[model samples]
Target: MRPKLLAAVLCLTLFGCASKQVVPTHNESRVQAEASLKAAESAGASRVPEAAQHMEFARQQIADAERLLVEGEQEAADMRFRQAEADADLALALARSIPLEREAQRATQQAEAARRSLQ
Candidate 1:
């Protein structure tokens, strides 16, 4: 009887360990997206408005994902997270365009010229 009890306890411990862990909060996903956006901007991205729009969209998706996760819809939440990630990637690509970069450079030069004139 003691051996049977030990076996049951061992089985329970193993099962507990094997269960999937809880998903992280939506804030974490937003933070990750924001970090990616900052990295892209630091790398000379110029389409700030477009990137901002995409970031907003990603934020919405993350909210949805979080809601689904809270409702125990793990698969749906995962899908939303994937979509949010894709949106962030799209924003990064748009921000990295050469035309936008050139526009940003021209704007920076103009601003510097204005500053110099004021000085």
Candidate 2:
């Protein structure tokens, strides 16, 4: 019984140490989220309604992440930052794609008109 208890304590101690090691002391996720948000804004996410909504959500997530960090909730804060980054990235993509989609539609219309004229 004594040996079993000692082994269990040792295993728990090792597990605790390993878990602590896995958590990062610095919040790189926050930095990435901020960068992504900035990129999204630069891409003109506000002009597209969906992108704008995502950007706003990202901002809120970032704010929440900051608050979490203040409360010593590093893991939660990091997760929030990651979520914000994803939203911002999505916003950026939408902002870029909408214009391209419009252009593609216009080109397709022109092609159809040209074919009809040739006929």
Candidate 2 lDDT over 1-119, as tens digits, reads 99999999999999998887455443688888889999999999999998999999999999999999899988888889989999999999999999899999999999999999999
Candidate 2, residue 46: Cα displacement in angstroms equals 1.4
Which candidate leads in lDDT? 2
Give each model's whole-structure lDDT: 0.75, 0.91
lDDT of 1 by residue, 1-119 (tens): 99999999999999998896977665566566566656655654444677767766777887898899889987777777777777777777877775567898999999999999999
* Worst lDDT 10-window in candidate 1: 38-47
What is the Cα-based TM-score of model 1?
0.49
Which one is best on TM-score? 2
Residue 91 lDDT in model 1?
A: 72
